[model samples]
Target: MFQVALTGLLTGLALIIAVGAQNAFLLRQGIRGEQVLPIVLTCLLSDVVAITAGVFGLGIVLERWPSVLPVAQVLGGVYLIAFGVHAAMRAWRPGTLDAGDGTAMTTGRAIMLTLALTWLNPHFYLDAVLMLGTVANSFGADRWWFLAGTLVASVLWFFGLGFGARLLRGIFARPTAWRVLDSGIAVVMGTLGVGLLAH
Candidate 1:
């Protein structure tokens, strides 16, 4: 059980610790100190649900229903491109990175965006559902322990990222830093969007 749990934890971290739309948005919110708790909770809950679904056999459903993937791919690609464009605009004219900069997002809007970022990405489904599910199933009877480990990993990661981002507040105090960050986000999102479309 310990070995299976460790494997799940490490695998979960490996899949999640990547530069992507979800991480970028979370980091931005954390740095701005805007609805950080809600955002983090939303991410954590979403991951738990996704991971649970995968471990319980959503991956098999996905495999049997081939059309679902292409539909998700198209939707995810379009949404990512639109988001990337918005990020690019922000990069071009970054405002103050402070919470009181008159650019703070409303909690409702922030939550909606968080949901979109979490759900609309096909990669999220691939990683959280298909890949993780397949891997967890490989452990046979101990798969539940593996799933629990993944849940732990997800909890740690979202909390760490959402809270730890405050440490970078000093650097992000400058508009230039925001510009650079947004620009990087734009590139990553755009590239992923295009990749999904190409597939």
Candidate 2:
């Protein structure tokens, strides 16, 4: 069981460590030090739901209804492209991501955007629901332990990312850094969007 749990932790880390829509957005919020707690909690809870569902039975349902993934792909792809464009615009005119009252990137808006980035990505479902679920189910009697391991990984990651990003505050103090970050985000989002659409 311990070995299985370790495997789960490592595997979970492997999957979540990848740079994707959720991570990108979370990283930006983490750096800006704006609404970090709610955003981190949201990401963790969302992962909990997805991973638990996958470990239980959602993976099976997704497999049986293959059509669902394609639909998700189209939707996710479009959203990613739009987000990429938004990021590009920000990069072109990088500024402080003010967290002041009545600002554009309000807490509520940030949370909603985070939710969209999480759920709208087909890869999120594939990795959490289908892939992780399949692997956890393989653990048979120790599947729950694996679930525990994955949850732990998620906790460590979100908390670390949400808080740890402040370490880079020195570099990001300049608008140029923000511009570069946003530019990279734009490219990532646009490339992912195009890939999903082509798929």
Candidate 3:
């Protein structure tokens, strides 16, 4: 059980710890000191639901109905591209952290964007549902342990990222830093969006 859980943990981290849209958005929020707690919780709960669905059985349904992925791919791809454009705009003219040139990244909007990013992205579903599900199912009777391991990984990662990002607040005081971060986000989001579309 220990080894199996460890495997699950490592696997979850391998997939989760990357420069994805979700991570970038969360990092921005954390650094900006805006709705960090809710955003972190949103991420944590979303992962719980996704990984839980995968571990229990949703992967099988998705496998049998392979047609569902393409639809998700299109929708997700378009959304990602739009989001990337928004990031690019921000990069082009980054404002003061405290005053986003009157365009505040509010809590409600942030939460809604987080939901869209979480649900509309087919890549997320692929990783959490299909890939992780396939892996957890391999544990057979000990799949619960695997689930627990993955859950722990999600919890640790979201919490660490959301809170730990505050440590770099000092660097983001300059508008140039914001531009650089947003530029990176724009590139990543755009690339992923295009990949999804091409897929």
Candidate 4:
């Protein structure tokens, strides 16, 4: 059980640490101090749904669907790379804000955007649902424990990312910081995309 839990935790953390489209968006929203909680919660919930599907043996079905995976990889990879580039551009060119009070997002819009970003990415299915599921499945009955541990990690990570960004709000007040963050995001996302395509 302990081994299973540790493995799940590590796997979850590894995947979450990657600078993907969803995460990039999350970070940007965080910096902007938008509807941070709603966006973060949606992302975390999406992960829970996908991870549950994978741990429940849906990953095996996805593995069997070769065409699905490739198409998804291609589309998702393209989206991620494009999103990265866009972020970089945003960083390069700071935009004037017409809205005040620091709230640029709404609950409905946040849910839709987060859901699309989190769910539409095939990489999410491949990495979190399928790959992580496969690892958990190897433990047989221990799979439940592994999944529980992983879910806990996910919750912790999402909350930290959402709320913790508040601590850095001051830094984001400067345009230079946005430039740096977006440029770094672009590099990371581009690298991840190229690597995925290579594989």
Give TM per candidate. 0.94, 0.95, 0.94, 0.85
Enumerate residue pairs that collide in model 4: none
- Return the candidate ranking by TM-score, descending: 2, 1, 3, 4
Show the lowest summed lDDT stretch of 10 residues, model 2: 95-104
- After superposing candidate 1 on the true structure, give the runs of residues whose Cα lies further than 4 Å from its correct spot: 96-103
lDDT of 3: 0.86
lDDT of 4 by residue, 1-199 (tens): 8878888888788889776778777877776778888888898888788888888999989878767877766766676677677767776676742112555567798788778667657788888888888988988989988898788888888888877877877877777777778788888777766655665
CA lDDT of every candidate: 0.87, 0.89, 0.86, 0.77
Candidate 3 residue pairs in clash (backbone atoms < 3 Å): none
Per-residue CA lDDT of model 1 for 1-199, tens digit only, reads 9999999999999999999888988988888777888888899899999999999999999889868888888888888889999989988876643444424688788888889888988888899999999999999999999998998999999999999998988898888888888888889889888888999
Best candidate according to lDDT: 2
Model number with the top TM-score: 2
Q: Write the per-residue lDDT of candidate 3 for residues 1-199, one digit (tens) a residue.
A: 9999998999999999999888988988888777888888888889999999998899999999999989988998898899899989988986633323313667788788888888888878899998999899999999888888988999899889988998988888788888898889999999989999999
The candidate with the higher lDDT, 1 or 2, is 2
Question: In candidate 3, residue 146 scores what lDDT?
Answer: 88
RMSD of each: 1.6, 1.7, 2.0, 2.6
